[model samples]
Target: MQEIFSAILGDQLGPFGPLILMGTLGAVLILFTLPVLLKKKQDPLDRLRDQIKTSKDVANGKAPARLRYDNQKGARLEKYSAFLEPQDEEEYSAAQLKMIQAGYRSKNAVRMFHFAQFAMGLGALALGLIYALLKSAQQDMSPKSLVLTVLLPGVIGYMAPKYWVTRRIEARKEEIVNGFPDSLDLMLVCVEAGQSLDQAIIRVAVEIRAGFPALADEYEIVSHEIKAGKDKSVVLKDMAERCGVPDVASFVTVLIQSQQFGTSIADALRIYAAEMRDKRVMRAEEAANKLPTKMTLATMMLTVPPLLIILIGPSVYDIYTLLNETNF
Candidate 1:
């Protein structure tokens, strides 16, 4: 009965082997091709929306008509606008929407990044399957072995992109955080110069371009949204949330409160900027203090072992020589 069953299974898989191979290849091809197809379908809608938005902005005196129409020589502004849409729109507040617009150049790039991850996973699985088949051709292949060899690589490949995205987000957030204090200082200067809060934010965004490009980009978005007639408090709050940083959120909260109570914007900015700088300094000091502790394990593993090897080596070698000379 077992032999009969085995024979039946072998016969079924034999004729279908070529078909299975073809299907697997087709699946991988589709895995790569589908994203491109979907992006093509989606691009027109994105472009139309951006054009409408730009037109509205120009009509409202939010952005100059020239700014909307002026393209770098040979540049496709429509394509650029479509590419600049925010990723994870639902996750952003109005302020955050501005920041995302300013900071990330391509929303489609984000989507393509995710798609590339999936393609890599599929490719890894295909490679594993190919390797397994080739190896099996030279030896016996068990079901368990086949599953491990093929599936492991696929799973690892699939996870790589997710891990990469998470790391990138963290690194970007840190970059923004590191630049925040300087941006705040610039805002304070603008406020002191008699600019209104919104105007100050725009100026800071412009002024900090050379030094803190990421924060400048975020500020540019805030300026754009304000120009579009969004409520000031709402935009600030949204910006804080989108930034996903405690310091920026605290600063935004201060701005919102100051705006609500008609407090001095310059004073608020000055105080917050000082506090941020102090916190940054303390953080650096704390990190410096921890370095000795961090080095302790390495010191023991590296320094102590080398010292021991130097101190004990001659005695051990002499004993070995003496023992050898005396015979076993």
Candidate 2:
């Protein structure tokens, strides 16, 4: 087998040709076989239905079965969590909060996140070292180049999970912002229709779910928390913290103050909902106002040059022709 691989790849890969070929073939085999080995017995449709049912259960004041099972799964991670998770309380809390904001409320999410970073960094570092060794065997490599090649992948791999989490947080924030106005309008309607605040939230969650699932999910969680006999103020504050949106924080403040001062909740919702709509419109206008500035460079780069060339080409061509004729 070594001789066969050497005969096939020795010219391109040098002395390590057989070893590299076997390693590559082994990786490919794992890629193909791992999914089969890990295949689950549950049908995909059933899994999706289960998720939907879990949401419905929460909305109806029942504890989600999925969450109960997740607690059990979380216990498995707890055994090694000290190794997998950050030891600093502040750092761990910050990471957990980020995970929550990114819509991952699982107890094991932070543990899994740190574990992923470690696994990816270790794997990438190994691959990088192997590649550097292969390259060094093929050609002379400076120590600096070798160091860079080995460390760059490891650094990038370690940070990739954090980057993904940041992107998720941004995307979730944008979705919440876009949907908040609509949800507020729906809540306002529910409130005006004589439903209590808690009922209004549940209704709004169900009604706006098709269009704005993230915001709806937040509302659903609030409803579930409220149903569990938690203090309404604390639940609202928790929702704001989980959302990390200024608009939501303000809304929570409004609700809290209204309750404190004996103001009508319906009136508060009505006023705040209108303000939210205005804010949404203002955001749209602000984006539109910046459009011209954003497009100015693109317009010049793409349109002005072509126009200039079209206008001057014939004149330049005529001048060149006249100069040539005069010389002739």
Candidate 3:
């Protein structure tokens, strides 16, 4: 065990071991991130649509070898999805909804998340053990510190994937909230141009890709559902739930009311768009108003010490010099 730890920490295997470890890690990171970096930013719905199309091609025996391999990986992930998910129907459905809101609507996404959590936990535990072993050989550390070094990282690693997913959900919501009004404006324009609500939505989805891809993608899904003969209110409600945003839910509620009451849909959208823009401006102003408080600590850390030294440093220096002269 000591020898293994030494080799892992590069004491026995020497510099070459660390070099190899870093190289392997770099390669793994590159492999994981390269495809993501290379692909143009696309909406999740659009990506899913493409994935569905690819699956259809494979079913028809027209997919390439690469696509076949991709499909196999997806299937393999799906097999493990049940392990991450609860067996209880109610709890599983809730967890699934949370995953969807986090832009993880792919069937295998939760499985992949669980896999990542396990991998990270094991890796952290291994690294922590290696660290503890190496340090114990070189110094007399306390048992408490050793235990903490090993267990803390293991716990954090296990939780990291879930934390990251939560952050993704928050970021997705923020993006949707920020871009929603512009999308509404575009939809309003289309509606005023004599397009039906469904047609207007499709147009807005196409037009808003550059500015707000996520919202545009949701709109695209709405269009597809409508075309598939789903009730607008039901589909829009689904979108609101999937997004998990109060603003979107309220907007959908407005649309449903307009439809139910046979009100002027275009006028309703125009008025709602104005309200959204105002709300966005208010949010911005609120953030701006809080900037000074947020900056206070940083300002003190950077500026206060220098000001104190400038004010009192010279007097202390003078006193030291005088006392030295008097031999006090």
Candidate 4:
């Protein structure tokens, strides 16, 4: 293979053909094998054991192991977090909020996100530089092209993490929006059925997991926080912020006000759930109303040109044939 590579690229690559080929093969081999080697191995029963332990801990009114593990991981990350996080307090908080809203609530979430951005950008820059070098060696590459080749990938890589987080946040918001009304209805039922607000929240979280895991997960967090003896208002408010949904914010306000002004919780849930159902209906109708306008361009692009050709093609062909006859 070395001889074959050298013979094939002896002129272009000169004496370095085998070396380049060997390096490429090594890189490819590492690319294929590194992930498998780096992946942490877990026993098949590990998840079951963790689940059983967590259930027992929760039943015994103790903090779950998962939370402790997360805290420990966060502490470990903190030691090297200087370069892994934004220096600006506001930016750090914003990034953390974004991460939470995107369904990542680990304390190391911000650090990991920033690290991903740095790693991706650096890797892309290196790859671009390697490509530029190779191309320059293989053939002439204009300076503008070279600069673009070296910089474009880095810019895109630097922005990719943010782009992904933004998309995740949007997708989570949509899920929460779509599933929230049902959750509200269920919560209302739970409240009406004589369960306390906390139990109702936990019940809703459990029930809603199949259809809308994101909203369910948020409810579960709210339930856990409430169980942990956090101020209910603060917990609700934090949930609202983490969700970043207006409906959720309004729901939180309603609960807070109901508690403050001595209004009935069941009544508030009933009213809010009705409103949410109505809003869901309205949203569906709005989407339906906009469908034709959204489809108009597609309709024209797909249907009109072929239709015109079908209608006018014979006439145009006849005219062309007549012109040719006249010219001849």
Candidate 5:
């Protein structure tokens, strides 16, 4: 038993063993502590509840009307509120701005994305370091080579998250765009069925919830804005701006103008939906036309080099054999 314990201790405390133990402990500590720290810092509901309490106190003349929360999250909330503030200098409450900003937006998910990026970068750095250490310990490596090996992986890791984020954003935008015409068609049907514009938006939002959650989410934001007493035009415009899609923006502008001019909303929506469908058809045809070009490029990349190698290799070997025979 004594010998066994001594062997175990010797293995653990061998050369560079302490370093391994320290690294493991540090990693475990970070994993255990980071969530606790982030959770403590990120409880928005607590801040919101505090804000409500402060508002009640101020309204009852029990406390001075001054800002209470002073964290980064609070500051971000304030900035978002300022951005959402109506330009007419009306007595618009900050609550409305907060609601608008929070409506259908995943604050934690955005933060988690950034966190994921950081973790990826750190992982890459660790991988690079491990590679460098292993190479240096196992083989005679120069300092420059070690540095290059270590730094290259870290750099790749840093850029990977940015690339992933960009791809996700593009994919989400495409999904929203693809779902727009259908949502518009549903709205048109609802309007023709005698629902008001707001009701139509709500009905369409509900209808699209299963198939296109992203579009449904945007419409839900519009519904929230309307419920918050924002004007229909403003809500629609905000939806367009938030979506950042040209077709949706144009549709919103057209709807606003039609409403202002007493034009038929259903007719305008139907026309827009028809136009979008036509555009989608054109895009499909364009993609189909490009398929041959894409295929040609792919074939050149994947097939041509191998074909050249196979065709040239036997001839080159034959020529070499003939030249050797002549020399003999």
Candidate 6:
């Protein structure tokens, strides 16, 4: 039976084959989301009927209701989330902020994140089991190889969520850095039009919501924080920190200084706006300068080798044929 099992599962497919198989299993587990999403999505007609029902209730002086969610699913998620919750206060806050930076900020976002982390760890372990079994069959089925193969992927699976979240934070920070100059320009225009800084932020958020939503969301949050009795300078500083943009930090600094010294905000904003525009232009020129060097490397990798082969192969073949005809 062991021989039969080994023969069927252990065909040699090179060093990368087991790894590819494990990756395929991980990908298959990810597809579980498709069924959940498809199941939860209501038909257009069903949604329309729900909307009509809510409208009629509002017309009849009754409160309109929100869509019903599955309590059992929520409970299960919360349970799994608690299983993976961070123990340290700082770690918990950092995790929450990372999720927010990744554009998840609902009340349940933290819970959902922890749940996903748990799911991925289990999925990785299962994939590692199959990979380990396959590898053991193909080669020496030792305890050490089994332990090494299973343990490595299991550890990677446990840390994958953190890695993905870190990537999202960096990507979000880059967007803020790239789009912030325009957002600053828009807010400057609003400030010059005699709007208060708070009002300017609100207006800018509306204006740039489609083009620069990440920055707009920060602005929107600032507006809400101010309305909710937070100090404007503190909120602005917090936003800059959360965005992780040096330009935004400088912009916030100027705004805070202007407010403190009773300076003309319009003047302050105008000067900063010009500086941001110049910085953006310089960044573009720098990227353009690097393009040629990058393309040179790409040409060497993708073009030069092919050309060399094409130019040399026919001559080499001709020389061989000539030598053969001369009976050399």
Which of the numbered candidates is closest to the native, going by highest lDDT?
4
Candidate 4 backbone overlaps, count: 0
Alpha-carbon TM-score of each model against the true structure: 0.69, 0.74, 0.74, 0.77, 0.64, 0.68
lDDT minimum window of 10 residues, candidate 6 = 33-42
Candidate 5 residue pairs in clash (backbone atoms < 3 Å): none
lDDT (10s digit) by residue, model 6, range 1-328: 5445346555563344455455657757766764454344458999999899888888998965655875565565653443457778899888777788887776566677777776787678778877765675567655566666777787888788878888888888888888888887888888878899899999999988887788889999999999999998999899877787789899889989999999998999889989989998999999999999989989899998899889998999999999999995
**Candidate 6 structure, TM-score to reference:** 0.68
Report the lDDT tens digits of candidate 4 across residue range 1-328. 7678767776564444455456557756865785456455568799889989888889999954454334766675565576678889999999899999998887789988887887798688768767866876687666687768878998999999999999999999999999999999999999999999999999999999999999999999999998899999999999999999999999999999999999999999999999999999999999999999999999999999999999999999999999999999
Error of 6 at 93 (Å): 2.3
Model 1 residue runs over 4 Å out of place are 1-114, 139-142, 324-328
Worst 10 residues of 1 by lDDT: 73-82
Which 10 residues in a row give candidate 3 its minimum summed lDDT?
12-21
Pitting candidate 3 against candidate 4, the one with the higher TM-score is 4
lDDT of 2 at 327: 100
Best by TM-score: 4
In the range 1-328, model 5's lDDT, one tens digit per residue, is 4455446555433344344445646866886776555443437999999999998998898986555645575344443332223434443433233333333244333334345556677788678767655654555666576667767887887788567655655665687888988888888889889999889989998998998887888888889889999999999888876666788889989999998999888889889999999998998999999999889989999999999989998999999999999999
The lDDT per prediction is: 0.72, 0.86, 0.82, 0.87, 0.72, 0.79
lDDT (Cα, tens digit) per residue for candidate 3, span 1-328: 5556455674543433443355447756865785456455568999999999999999999996654345565665554454555678898778778888888777666567777897798688667766865665566557587768667887989999989989989999999999998989888999999999999999999998998788888988999999999998999999999988899999999999999999999999999999999999999999999999999999999999999999999999999999999995
Could you give the C-alpha RMSD of every candidate to the true structure, in order shown?
8.2, 10.7, 10.9, 10.2, 9.3, 11.8
Candidate 3 regions exceeding 4 Å error are: 1-71, 77-82, 137-141, 325-328
lDDT, residue 106, candidate 2: 82
For candidate 4, report its TM-score: 0.77
lDDT of 4 at 123: 82
